[model samples]
Target: MAKEATLQVRMDADLKEKAEALYRDMGTSFAEAVRIFAKQSVQENGMPFAMTANRKNTYGRLSGYANTKLAAEEDGAYEREMVGKHEKTD
Candidate 1:
């Protein structure tokens, strides 16, 4: 085998710990699992699973709850005017 290279990724600390524990239960280290995924992706020429979700419009969907407040914004200002439900602020 050729010399191995390091791959660094940063994520939420809690999520990383959860993933590590799950991989341990499955009898594989996180790095080993990532290697298997990389090899499979290379052999398949792309992701080996279907991604049917509309991920490109993600910000639109994610911000829907704040749409009314954001509607009044111009040039991209979105400061909240209400402190909570049924509560208005000065």
Candidate 2:
């Protein structure tokens, strides 16, 4: 058997409590959930899920435009605009 190591993490008290309750309802502990996440991350060679910036917070009022279509479409448009600006300057 492999030696077990302790992993400590800090988070808001409310967030921790909520996460614990969520995992408990799923018939698992938060610690076990974290372990599963770690194992999956190792297997995937990176994060198990995509990491993306919160567009609503990053762009502020631009979230209003997101109502026109999917939020992904807005994010794509923003990325294209940024690339176009860089191309024009180069």
Question: Per-residue lDDT for 1-90 in model 1, tens only?
Answer: 774698897767997888789999999988788888889989999865544345456444545434455466542433333334336432
| Candidate with maximal TM-score | 2
Q: What is the TM-score of each candidate against the true structure?
A: 0.55, 0.56
Candidate 2: stretches off by over 4 Å:
1-3, 54-90
- The C-alpha lDDT values of all candidates are 0.68, 0.79
Q: List runs of model 1 lying over 4 Å from the truth.
A: 54-90
Residue pairs with backbone overlap in model 1:
none
Over all chains combined, what TM-score does candidate 2 have?
0.56
Error of 1 at 46 (Å): 0.4
List, residue by residue over 18-83, the lDDT tens digit for candidate 2.
Answer: 999999999999998999999999999987766445554534444444455555567778779999
